[model samples]
Target: MRHTWRWFGPVDKVSVREAAQAGAQGIVSSLHHVPTGTAWTTEEVEKRQQEVRAGGLEWELVESIPVSESIKTMSGDWKAHIAAWQQSLRVLAKAGISTVCYNFMPVLDWTRTDLRWETPIGARAMRFDLIDFVAFDLHMLQRPNARAEFSAAVIEQADARFRAMSDEKKAALSRNIGAGLPGSSDGYSIGELTEALGRYAAIDAGRLRKNLIHFLSEVVPVAEELGMRLCAHGDDPPWPLLGLPRILSTEADYLEVLRGVDSMANGVTFCTGSLGVRPDNDLPAMLRRLAPKIHFFHLRNVRREEERMPCSFFEAEHLEGNTDMVAVIAAIVAEEKRRKAEGRSDHQIFMRPDHGQEILEDITRGAQPGYPAIGRLKGLAELRGIERTLSHASYGLA
Candidate 1:
């Protein structure tokens, strides 16, 4: 595993120098100033790369050059958006950034009801409470047929939760879920969001997936030609939410995507925390099975509340979540070994410690919601220790 960190450009609270100091081998970043669907110029890509190199690190992966919503729904100048997306890929490749991470989650990128859910250790972490989300969907957003989506028990609980909250708390919940996070596409206002969800009213998981495959069919060839790997990030929580269909949430989803495009350039950005939300995901086993198509990794463990669909979850210490950290690391290390045996140059997958808990100095530093400086440094340290141990053990007797 190649140690990597996601840096949100020069304006980020966590500087590139700090990232290098934290022992990151490379930087995962993006040109956030550019609007979605606009083609990134080669000059812009190189300028960012220069910044990364100046801090003594290479820009190995573009965390994302976002996919346009038009492309997702196949509406509103989608062909033009697809052409621009392809051009962006060409530009990125020319700038020597090989791996690109993106997602197809409609409307919001990732939803968290609480940005600072208090941890038992007095640290703060991002969390998604199922009841809170249901409250927003049924009582707050008031989506059509929202009551039908959840069981009566869940709806009743959500109603109580919704009725108990003050107006301020309700608005906070709305913003937390609808407002964009760092490196995501954009936020939606309540009115704007309702309209957006309305567009997807007829689009189910199957149709949305078909749209994704159609996208891959067009872009994967360009990626292949440019020697770039396009990594589709899995949906956070790995389930549908707010009536929007979620397709990229399971191993089966990935298999469909991989086989649909049938190109080496078509790959997945194996995000353990996102997929780990589902008890059925089997992280280590999935890692072993889909190792070849894993172009990048967002390595973080999530502690699932009830071990079922729509369960609450929060970011845990890198080694302390429900995921078997040691086993997952072993599978990754083993995959690298197999790739090396086959003489593949890109055997070492780029992985970054994702969504670290806010603790220590990070609590007051007010870093990006989940990308706290000290918190992620601590995570990287723990993950590095694990990687070193696993790598050493693979060598047989020392």
Candidate 2:
């Protein structure tokens, strides 16, 4: 794929121009200031595209459209919200921005409990350690099913872990998970988290999937008309646990959603990091099977630990993760070649080093993920070497 860096627009510590200078040809971004369920106008889309283009970079992917709560809950004004979403897609299409990336992770977008995860290189990376997450959910937030979310054995494990953690450690984990993404719908206090889980207590996995399909069925045709394509990311570990509903958890789940809408406009964002957390994902094979369906890619790595409950534990480290980065990149290259052979006009897929550490120079100051110069430069360097070497040497011994 084409090299794209994640840009959070002008307000981002890392600007679009900076990304251009970072050897990036494209910028994967969103109108983060736009609240969920709001209609983004053609003017708004054009302005953002112009800004990116002015920075000497192409606006390659809209990282998300931010699915609304009503749309997710299938409640009041949902149809109107879906229509607004369709309108936003048309607006982008009119502006000639064809690629859009979105995720269906409920409430929070890619939740993590620790922003200062450790790496062997003496650099601290952001991670979603399961024990840290569980401690926050059960003890800090005190969500009703939080305790039950952890398996019985794991609950005991978590109790010991929580007891062992100092007041400072628990405080950090709570802040980390709740600091919230820049433009998240609502910031959760511990109280809100409890209430939110209870609200979702009624919407099971099946209902959530149905809502997703219904939302897709409604707007995918609009995507087709605009010649716009969406890269819908799957919900990690889709099982209904602790009353949290999951729509796109498995390969079958993905297939069901895809088959429901059945549109070229409807596609998936294949984040190797998210899927790689599960050993069963089989990254290389997933590429072969889902090649035709993936519209964008998030290439990163994660190590899986099966012992953790709710989510089998995973840690993000570009090279060390369970997802075979080498094979995954090779499959990506092959897919691009296949697309080219099939006469596809879509440009190379957009990718970013999903999340990076608050490292060396950055640790003393800054948010956890947004602008990590050292870690991401290292990650991009590694991936660049991987891509170039693989392009030269078929599949092995490169």
Candidate 3:
């Protein structure tokens, strides 16, 4: 497996050189300056790709060409936006930057209710508490159907938290949820966020998933023709987005989308941490089955709520999560072996430590989605150890 680092364009605090030194062979990034609904020109992609080559690393993937909200909800002029996306794909193909990772999570790319929740180690990590989410949805946004979405037990817990909270604390909670957290398109206020959520309210999981398939059907071939892969990462918890259907939460979703598009380009960034959060998920079995379409891999661990109320989340060590890391790595090793036996050069999967917890000296600062130095460094080290240890076991020849 070839590891890549997600760099946030030129302004990223972490340099491409740093990424190279960290042992990443490829850079997973995007044209952050390019707005949604606009085509990313080949000139821009080549310019960024050049930077990677000069840094002694390859530019293998564009982590995203952020799909517009217009395209997601089919609001207005979506065809124009989709056409632009297609054209951009063609442009990227011409430039030879093929592998791309994108998400379909509406409004927020990913949500965390608290960015500064104190960890037991006295470090700050992003926390997604159920009560905090309810506090934002019911008390702050005051949606008409908010109460219906919560259970009696959840309502009781949320009510107690809401009552105990000062106005400033409540407002902060609302801002945390309403503001769309970080790594999303942009910050959203209460009104803006509620309206955004409302746009997807009419869309159920089936329709949303259908839309996602529709998108892949259009763009996947262009990628495949150019020998590129489009990897879709599953949005975490509650499965699908609040408004849109989540087709990718289950193995069937992956199969359906792959069949819908019928292109080699259509694949998945199998994220163990996100998929592992669900108890029913069997990562190794899924990997073995979907190995051909597994374009990218995300390795991380989550500590599930042991006995907590409402939402008891777990943030475990990279090797210490609910999902068996050793087994997952073994499956990956098996995939590599199978692909090699089949004479496929595209078997080198990309892996990254998805989201790690904040720890050590990073306690004082804000890091994007657990991208702190200590956390990621620790994760990379741990994952490297696992990969090396398992490298020998899975492929006996190694």
Candidate 4:
């Protein structure tokens, strides 16, 4: 696997130089300033490339070219957005970037209730507390029919949780849940969220899946012609949220999309942290089965707070979470060997330490939540160590 780091460009708290120092051989980034539905110009693409090159690293993949809400719903300007997306791909391919990662989750990119949940070891990690999320949806955003979505027990728990919070806490919780992640264009105010949710009133999982397939049908061919890989990231938390359908949450969902498009360019970005949120998504087994279509890896772990669906979870230490990191890494190494024996040029997958706990000087730096420099460095070191051990000739695992 090629080690890569996600950089949010020039304004990011962590610099590209720091990424290089953290031992990243390449970068996974996007032109975030380019608004959704707009085509990226070659000048903008080359500007970022020059920045990454100056740091002595290559821009290996685009973390995303944001899929606009218009395209997702097939609504106003949807066709135009598709054309713009195709244009962006042409520009990227011209600039020599071959892999692009994107997600189709509507309304929000990735939702989290707490950006600084304290861990037992005195580090800060991101968390998704189901009760807190329910409370926000019920009392804060007040989405219609939200009560029907939760079980009676969960509703009761959420009611109590909501009542116990002070006004400041309530506001913070709202901001954390509604505001989007660091490089995402989908952040929303409560009013904005309500309006967005209304647009999806008629679209369920099946329709959303069809929309995704339609999207792939339009864009995947361009990617294939460009010798580029378009990998769809699994839905974060791997479930529905805010009354919106999540079409890419399970193995079945991935199979549907892959089979729907039926091309090597139409692939999945095997994100263990997102898919692992569900108890049934056997990471190693899934990796082996989807080896051919898996194009990128986000190797982070989560410790589920409960066994039930819609359960709470926190980002745990890389090797300390519920995931069997060793088994997953071994599978990755084995797949690389198989690809080598097959003489495939796109054999080595690009991976990054997804979200790391905030620790050490990271506590004071106020780095992007879940993207603390030292914490990710710690994760990359551990992951690299495991890959080396598995690939060692004595182990015969590679």
> By lDDT, who's the top model here?
4
TM-score of 2: 0.91
| CA lDDT of each prediction against the hidden true structure | 0.88, 0.73, 0.75, 0.92
Best by TM-score: 4
Candidate 3: regions farther than 4 A off: 179-185, 238-244, 306-310, 393-398
Off by over 4 Å in 2: 164-167, 179-185, 237-242, 307-315, 365-371, 393-398
Error of 1 at 59 (Å): 1.4
Worst 10 residues of 4 by lDDT: 179-188
Backbone clash tally (model 2): 1
lDDT of 4 by residue, 1-398 (tens): 99999998887788889999998999999998988899999999999999988888999999899898999999999999999999999999999899999999887877899999998889999999999999999999998899998899999999999999999988888888887646754577888889999999999999999999999999999999999999999998788898899988888899999999999999989998999999989999999999988899999999999998999999999999989999999999999999989998988999999999999999989888889899999999999999999999999976
Clashes of each: 0, 1, 5, 0
Worst 10 residues of 3 by lDDT: 238-247
Report the C-alpha lDDT of model 3 over 131-204, residue by residue, as the tens digit: 76776667777777778766898889888888788888877776666553234446778778778878887888
- Model 4: CA > 4 A from native: none
Error of 3 at 218 (Å): 1.2
Question: What's model 4's TM-score?
Answer: 0.99
Question: TM-score for each prediction?
Answer: 0.97, 0.91, 0.92, 0.99
User: Considering lDDT, where higher is better, how would the candidates rank from best to worst?
Assistant: 4, 1, 3, 2
* Residue pairs with backbone overlap in model 1: none
lDDT for each residue of candidate 2 in 9-127, tens digit (9 for 90 to 100): 77666667766666777888788888778899877788888888888887877877888778888888888889889888878887778888887766665666665666677667656
Q: Is candidate 1 or candidate 3 better by lDDT?
A: 1
